[model samples]
Target: MSQEIRGHPQALIDAEKGTLDPLPGSLSHSKDVKPPPSDVLLSSKEKDALVTTTTQEVILSAKPTASSVPKSKRVVSRWTLWNLWFNTYRKFFTFTFGLNMIGLVLAASGHFPYGVKYSGTIVVANFNFAILMRNEVFGRFLYLFVNTCFAKWPPLWFRLGCTSVLQHLGGIHSGCALSGVIWLLFKVVNNFRKLNVTHDAVLVMGVITNLTVMISALSAFPWVRNTHHNVFERHHRFVGWLGLICTWVFVILGDTYDPVTRSWNLSGVDLIHHQDFWFTMGMTIFIALPWFFVREVPIDIELPSPKVAIIRFKRGMQQGLLGRISRSSIMEYHAFGIVSEGRHAKYHYMIAGVQGDFTRGLVQNPPKTIWTRELKFAGVSNTSTLYKRGIRICTGTGIGAALSTCLQSPDWYLIWIGSEQEKTFGPTISRLIHDNIEPERLTLWDSKARGGRPDTMKLLKEAYHYWDAEVVFITSNYIGNSEIMQGCKEAGIPCFGTLWDF
Candidate 1:
C-alpha cells in the first residue's frame, strides 16, 4: 500500500506521531435531524462493516495503541473536467456552430439562402442568452426542478458520478459566447456589404455591434481574466451592456431592411415577434435578476486573526449553500460558502480570507452592512445530494466551503487542515463544529500542534475506508485541491472539487 500525494512525504512524517483511538463496543445511531454531540465518536469495531463495496483493498487500523497508519495504493487518475467527460456543453455548442457554418456554406450556394443577415444575429444573441443570462425566472425554476428531481431518484454513486460534471456550465457559456461572436462577425459583414444605399441606417450600428461583441469575447479570455480580474469584470459587465444595447440597434436595422422595397419599416408587434428581440429581452432580465435581490444587509464581523475574518449575516442563507457578497452591489463580488444549521437556524456565516480588495476591506474596516445577492439555488454543495456518504477535504479558508455540508448531513465526513483553526477561525466556528458534528466524523488537523501538515492522502484514504464514503469533495487552494482530487481519481474513487473555469 504505497500512495503518492503532493507533500505526502512531509505529511506522513508528521502524522506518525498522531493517534487514532480504538473502537468502543456497539456504535449508537441518532434519530434527530441534528447531528449527535461531539461525544459521538463511532467505534473502530465497525470498520469491516463500514468500508465500501469497491474492489479496492480495505485495511482496518491495527490494534496497537501507537500503530502507524497503513499506506494506500495508487491508481491512475483520469481527467473528468476536460475533453469528453468535461466540456460536453462546449462541445455541443461547437457542434451546433459548426453545423451553422456548413449551413452558411450551403446558403452561399443559393440552396438555403433564408434568414441570412437577420438569423445570424439572432443565433448569436440566443447563444449569449443561453450562458450569460442564465438566472432568468423560468430558467432558474427549470434548473431547480432538474436539480431536485435528480437528487431523490438516481442511485447515490451513479448520481454522484454524473452530477460531478455540474461545474461544466461555465464551459457552455464560454463556447456559446465565442460562437456568438463569430456568427455576429459574419452578420456584420453581410450587413455592411448589403448596406442599403437608400437606407444605410444599420451600417454604423453593425460595425459598432461587431466591435463590441469582439471586445466582450476577447476580454473574457481565460488568461486575460486570470491575469486581470478587474478588467474582465468591467468589460464583461460594462462592455457587455454596451454590446447588448448595440445588438438592439444592429438587429432592428437589419430586420427592418425590406430587400425588395429598399426601405426601413417602423412597426411595433412585428419587431417584438422577431427571435432576437425576445432573446435580448430574456438576456436583459437574466442579467438584471441578481441585482434585483441586491440589498445591503446588516453584517456582524469578528476578526479572530489577521488571516481570517468570520463574517456572520443576520439573514441566513440556505443550508449547504454557497453565495456571493460584495462590498458594493456592482463590484468586488466574491463567492464563498455559507455555514448554517438549516432554515431554522438564526444566522449564517461566511469566512472571508484576506485575499483581495473586497476581503481585505472587510477584515480591516469591519463593515456594519454588506451587499449580497440572495438567489437560493443549487450551489457546489447541492451536488452533494447525489451521494449517500462522502468525505469533504479542505485547507485553511477552504474549511468555510466544506463545513456546511458536514453540518447539514450526518452522512458527510469533514477533514479540515489548517493552522490553529480554533484561534484563527475563532470560537463561533469551533463551537459550531463541537456542538453539531460527531467527533469521529470530523478530523481537525492543526499544523502548529502537529509540528507540520498531516499526511492528507493517508488521512483521506483512512476516512474513505472508515466511513464507507462513495465520493470525495475537496475545497482547498488550486494546488492542494487538485492534488487531492487527482489522487482520489487515481485511486478509482469518484471525486468532485472546485473548477476555476468561471
Candidate 2:
C-alpha cells in the first residue's frame, strides 16, 4: 500500500562537493568547516559547543549586522492584500461556500424547484469533492503533477501559487462538507413538506441522516476541533461513518420507492441509473480510500529526550510527505512529517516530538507495531523542486517538517533554530542534518546556548540573500511563523510558513 518516492539527483553526494557560490552583493563569508565523519558521534556537550562556535562564525562572517539591515516601512499594497487573500485557506473556503450559497439562495427562494433530487445531488457532489480534497492518494497525485510540470520552469509567482494549493485545500474540504450538510437539510426539509409522498423509512432516514451530518459538521468546528481534539476526532469520524451509512440507506430507499405509483423498484440496473445512488457511491469510495492503505507496520522509536521520539519506518519517502499513525487502527491517528534521504535510503523517519496524547505515549512506552496509512499525503514543501534554490527555516520540533526538504534537495539550504539541537531531538536528527547537509548551506542556531532567541528576521534576510534563494519556507510555532512571515512581507521577500488553519 505504501507509495514510492523517486530520489533527487545523486550529484549531492559527489565527493568534490563543489565550491560555495554566493549571489551578487551577498556576503563573501568563509565556508563552514566540514562536519565530522558520520561514524563519529559527538556528545551533547560537544555538539552544543560546536553549535555555539558555529553560530558565532556565521555572525562574524556576515558583513551586515542586525542594526545595519534596512528596516522597511510597513506598507501593505492593494496587490499584496489581493495576493494574500487569493492564497489563504479562508479564501478557498469562502470561494466554495460563496458559490454554493448562490445556488442555495435560489433554491430556498423557490425560484428554482430544487426538490429532493436536485438537493440530494448537490449534497452528494459537495461531500464527494470535500473528501477528495483531503484524500491521501489524490493529494499525492496533485503534488506530483504540480512539481513535475512546473518545477523550476514556471515563473516564481506561479510556483509560489502552486505551493499554496495543497496547504489550504482543507478550506475546500471544510466548505464543501458544510455545504453538503446544508443541502441535505434542504432535501430533508423538502421531504417533510411532502409527507404524504415520502415513505416512512425514507422520512426516518432523512431525519436521522440530517442529524448525524449536522453533528459531524458541528464537531469539526474550529473551537471544538482545537480545544477538544479527541471529542472532535471521535465524533467527527464515528458520526460521519454513521452519516454515510444512513446516506446509503436513504439513497436506496428514496431511489427504489415510487411515491406517485406507490410501487417499489428493486432492480440493480434501476438503482445504478439513479444520480444520487452514483454520487453516494463516489462519496463512499472517497471516504473509504485512505483506510484501504491502512496497515500495521513495525517501527523503531528513539527517545532522544522526554520531549521527542524519532520514529524509523521501513522504506523511504520523498520530502514534504506526511504519514498518519495511531496505536489503534480505528481512532486517535496523528500526522507527523516524514524525513528521509529519499528513495535510495533504507528507511524514512517521523519525528514524533511529544505534543499530544499519542506522541507522549511513544516516549512513555514505545510500540513494536503502529497503525499507519501506507500511502502518505503531500504538503507544501513537496514543491521544493519548483524553486532552483530555497531556504528551509524552522524552530524546535518544526525541524521535523523542514529537514526532509534540505536532506532531499541539494538546491535547498537549511536553517534550524531550536533550544537544544542535539539534546532535544536526539542523535538521529542531528546525524541526518550533519551528514546529509553540507556545512556551507546550513545554519543551526541553538537558543539555549545563545541565551535567548536570535533575531530571526535579520538571520532570514541575511540567508535569503547569501544563499541566493528564490523563496523561503518556514516551519515554526504560531508566533514565530507570524513574525517571520510579516517581516518577509514587509521586506518584499517571497516566503511561506506553517499554516495554522487546520
Using lDDT as the measure, which candidate wins?
2
Tens digits of per-residue lDDT, candidate 1, 1-502, equal 0000010111111111111211010111222223222233344356323432221111122121222322443343455334323444455446655766776676556676574645554454645445442442443454456567776477775576456445444444554565566667666676666755525667777778878767766766656555675676677667777877887777777666677787667787678777777776656666666667778888899898787788887755555556667778787456677788777788899877776676788888888988876764345566676666788887777767777788888778887767666777787887778677665576666555444555567667877766778788777655566557667766677776665434
Give the 10-residue window scoring lowest on summed lDDT in candidate 2: 1-10
The residue pairs that clash in candidate 2, if any, are: none
Q: For model 2, what is the error of residue 215's alpha carbon versus the real structure, in angstroms, after optimal superposition?
A: 1.3
Per-residue C-alpha lDDT of model 2 across residues 1-502, encoded as one tens digit per residue: 0011001101111100111111011111235564443234444345435532342123312333445333544455666656654566788888998989888888888777764347888888888888777777788888988888998987899988888766677778778888888888888888999989888899999999999888888876656655676776788788888888998999899889999987898998988987888888887887787888889999999887787788999998888877778899988667777889998799999876665787789999999999998987777788899998898887776777788999988778787766656776776776777667766567776554544456677777767766668899887765667667777887888988766534
What ranges in model 2 sit over 4 Å off?
1-86, 114-117
- RMSD (Cα, Å) for all candidates, in order, is 9.6, 9.5
lDDT of each: 0.60, 0.72
Q: By TM-score, who's the top model here?
A: 2
lDDT value for model 2: 0.72
| Count of clashes, each model | 1, 0
